[model samples]
Target chain A: QQQVKQSPQSLIVQKGGISIINCAYENTAFDYFPWYQQFPGKGPALLIAIRPDVSEKKEGRFTISFNKSAKQFSLHIMDSQPGDSATYFCAASMSAGHNFNKFYFGSGTKLNVKP
Target chain B: DAGVTQSPTHLIKTRGQQVTLRCSPKSGHDTVSWYQQALGQGPQFIFQYYEEEERQRGNFPDRFSGHQFPNYSSELNVNALLLGDSALYLCASTPDEGFGGYTFGSGTRLTVV
Candidate 1:
């Protein structure tokens, strides 16, 4: 089962536009949600993460909006730039015992920003 | 300090052969996990090691196995390799304490012919 599901397999946006990717999870036990950005030939790098306790967390141009009641979350990039073009993955994890460290990742979204 | 380190960035092997991939966790980290990523697909967990023991595993078959040493470095051994086994193998590390995400290595690309 795909515990985490992401939408918009690929996206193209004009420079300075807002890029949005959405994801949802089925497991209510998930308490930690994180987004990762990956460039070609490299490992996925953590972008921003939010816990169920908060509705939104932002850092620089990247923001993660989470809804625990809905088991949904999204990553919004404001003023998108060419440098932001890359594959984005959304992941969910549980912090309890036994499975405290494993992450369930979504398929991924390939974003391309045109200047 | 060095991040997670993986050896032999790339490898090629024949079907039915056995291959071993290695990983060294980030300095001071005691837990290591392996993931497999196929082309155009997200990573799939293989297994995790802690305290020189296999603590958790994914849905992979028995042909996929691993071991962890006292130093926390780990090795993934795949026996009877198949063409479907070709993928990028990634190793991630995290400290046992605190609630933080894992740090991943560049990964070892394995091609099975």
Candidate 2:
């Protein structure tokens, strides 16, 4: 089964604090994992992504840590800001056959960063 | 480059009705994927279109169908809508696997009465 599970259905943090969301998957065929940010009245956008070959990746304030053995990964926001308050989703895919087509997504976690 | 675009930001329909939602992919993108996000839940994959063909599909029933045009634009048609079908529909576009992460459209919010 293609399934991605995310934790911390909701998160609240103070500005400058670290905000983290975790996800686990059952399918080992998945090679690409991406994190998306979504605000109200908008669609989710790709914030950052990671491949299984790497242990971690960082882009500006966003980072993704991956564990190939455990089939687990997570997103970390350094120095969280109020503007970061939104819903985040973790998704995985078997990029090989898809031409990167078929992808699976996690339920999502709503983050509320306070000033 | 212009990002993916969708139509009819919001719509309302009653049970047994049919609805159509449209999407235009980002500039230079050739593939489009559709997703359904219910309240407080993650977006579920409905289907994906590439090269003007239905390349893949999710677990959704046949009532949930779609079409893709040569221009890389796409449409999602839901026949005999039900209350459970009410959700935010999103469209995503990408060039190929090498291009990576998708660019998603703002989405069409549908409510069923």
Candidate 3:
């Protein structure tokens, strides 16, 4: 079973435009939701993360809006730039003891920002 | 400080052969985890190691084995490689305190013919 589901397998946006990607999860045990940005031939880099306690968290132009009751979360990138073109993955994990932070990741959303 | 480092960024093996991949965790990190990522897909957790022992594992076959050293580095071993085993293997590391996001390596691409 896919623990975390992401939508819009691919996305294209104009530079300076807002880009959004959505994700949903079924596991209520998940407490930490994080987003990763991966460039080709490179490792996935941590972009932004949020906890269930907070409905929203923003870092620079990246924002994560999380809804615990709905079991859904979304990433919003303001002023998308061509350099932001990469694959984005949403992951959910429980941070409790001995969990080893095993992450359940979404398939990923390929984002392209045309300049 | 160096991030997670994986060795021999690429490899190719024949079916029925065995392969081993290595990873060095980030400085000050004591936990390591392994993941397999198929082309155009998200990474799937393989297992995790802490204190040089396997702590948690995902739903992978017994052919996928791993070891963590006292220095906190780790190795993943696969026996009798199959075509389906061709994928990018990633190593992630974090402190044992929890909630610290993982730092991933560039990954080693394995191709099995």
Evaluated on CA atoms against the true complex, candidate 3 attains a DockQ of: 0.87
What lDDT tens digits, residue by residue, belong to model 3 across residues A40-62? Answer: 99989999999999999999999
TM-score of chain B of each: 0.98, 0.97, 0.98
TM-score of chain A of 2: 0.95
Local accuracy by lDDT, each model: 0.92, 0.92, 0.95
Best candidate according to TM-score: 3
* TM-score against truth, every candidate: 0.98, 0.97, 0.98
Docking class of 1: medium
| lDDT of the structure predicted as candidate 1 | 0.92
How far out, in Å, is residue A114 in model 2? 1.2
Question: Which rank order by DockQ, best down to worst?
Answer: 3, 1, 2
Task: Report the lDDT tens digits of candidate 1 across residue range B15-75.
Answer: 9999999999999999999999998888889989989999988899999999999999999
lDDT of 2 by residue, A3-111 (tens): 9999999999999999999999998888889999999999999999998989999999999999999999999999999999999999998777653556688999999
- Candidate 3: where is the Cα deviation over 4 Å? A97-100
Top-DockQ structure, candidate number: 3
> Candidate 3 clashing pairs?
none
Q: Which TM-score value belongs to model 1?
A: 0.98
Q: Cα lDDT of model 2 overall? A: 0.92
